[model samples]
Target: MTYPPPGSGYPGPQGPYPPAPPPAPPGPGYGSPHGGGKTNGLAIAAFVTGLLGCFGVVGIILGAISLGQIGRTGDRGRGFAVAGIILSCLWIAAGITIGVIAANSDSSGGSGAAPSATRTKPKEVDAQKMKVGDCINDNTTASAPSTAEPVEVESVKIVPCTSPHDGEVMAVFRLSGLTMPPESQLRQRASDGCKIRTRSRISRDPAANSLANSYYYPTDESWRSGDRSVTCVAVAANEGTKLTRPLAR
Candidate 1:
């Protein structure tokens, strides 16, 4: 073999390869191994808002927007968006159901019904049949009896005074005439009579301050139906308290 001179054919290794061409600039969809797309921000928001019941509607709208964004931008979190939408839908449905039930209860006079431990239906009775010292539950729609309008007594349940009762009858009196008086005059008379009766029955005590008088009198329709008696009752000043004894003098 002929010997070649050193440094002539293989150039003595003075320069190293050229630094490898700068690593090829990392290709098309590079940095993240999974994909270059980001997780959708609106998708995350929708999920968080859905967990809070009050914002369920808003969450549904946001979840829809997130799905559109993910479809176009190749973003992640489609599962989150779907879950948020489902949760929001269920929340709305529950709210609607509760509202319907509440509306039905109000329409059926359930709001005016007395609280009974036994849940017995109120018994219908003539207004004249209510006597003094009777503990009764008045299931009438009228919150306060008015002389202007005939207050119809729908039903009454006579319960023991010791048990939970609505009101205690203090006095029973007659308006005394074939013709009914004006509503304002009748209301005034009923109010005055109830006040007198309550004062006469209850002595000056702290409980007296918390006692209020209510009266039921004949309306024009009731008067035509042969109802003439006015029933006075002593009730708690605030709701949820029962008159546990006769309030009459």
Candidate 2:
């Protein structure tokens, strides 16, 4: 049998549906009752900057947090969150492109050139092993079998000379690998494929092989070894020119 119902186990039909459970306490950062829910100023700034990519990924983080909080308070600013995502994507794209270009420009010159940089050799100095800041005082030309027919390269040698046309200064870097240049990088400022190119020559030293037998300078192409690519400048070794010494590497 049911007991009398005043404050019994079962409530009467009325009682306003148990007076609705007490509202949940405000979240951690919401503070005391006197203080109301407030958003962080830095978070707002980050969200805005992130959309511009100025904040990069940092902005994305801030915007995400702010966006999440908005759900709890029904706030606005979808623009800021979207902006942060856009910025992060842009930063990633730019960074990736830069990294790839640098890698391509640095393909290697596989041999022992980089390691033997300290060794001294007989006859002509191995100039290719020189360092960035180091300067050579001698201009001893090295010789190899002429790769071109008719021994067009005589014996693959070089001397010193200055530019008559006085071309502008261009790129610079250390020498490595076989020192053989890429076919594309060099051009005879005067002739087709230039009969003979010099690094920066005005004339040839009879001492270091003749123009007919010398290696062309101002190499039109870049060369690769184990893992390094060397750049060269173009200088023709035709007549009306001379070779100087202590060539700059």
Find the candidate with the highest TM-score and give its number: 1
TM-score of 2: 0.31
Q: Candidate 1, residues 1-249: lDDT per residue as tens digits?
A: 877887557644566545445566755654543667788999988888887868959989999999999888778888889888888888899999999999998667586776555544445566568888777876553323222244567557887776677777778887777888998888788878777766766555347777777788777888898887778877777755666665535
Candidate 2, residues 1-249: lDDT per residue as tens digits?
968877656656675575668999987764443345564454566666755665557876776777776656645555566566667777778878988877765554334335232232212333344232222222222222123221111111122223122111123333344555444433222222223334234243333343332232322222333423221323223443332333333
Question: Candidate 1, which segments miss by more than 4 Å at Cα?
Answer: 1-124, 141-151, 204-206, 245-249
lDDT of 2 at 161: 28
Q: For model 2, give the RMSD to the true fold.
A: 18.2
Pairs of residues clashing in candidate 1 = none
> Whole-model lDDT, candidate 2?
0.40
For all candidates in order, the CA lDDT equals 0.74, 0.40
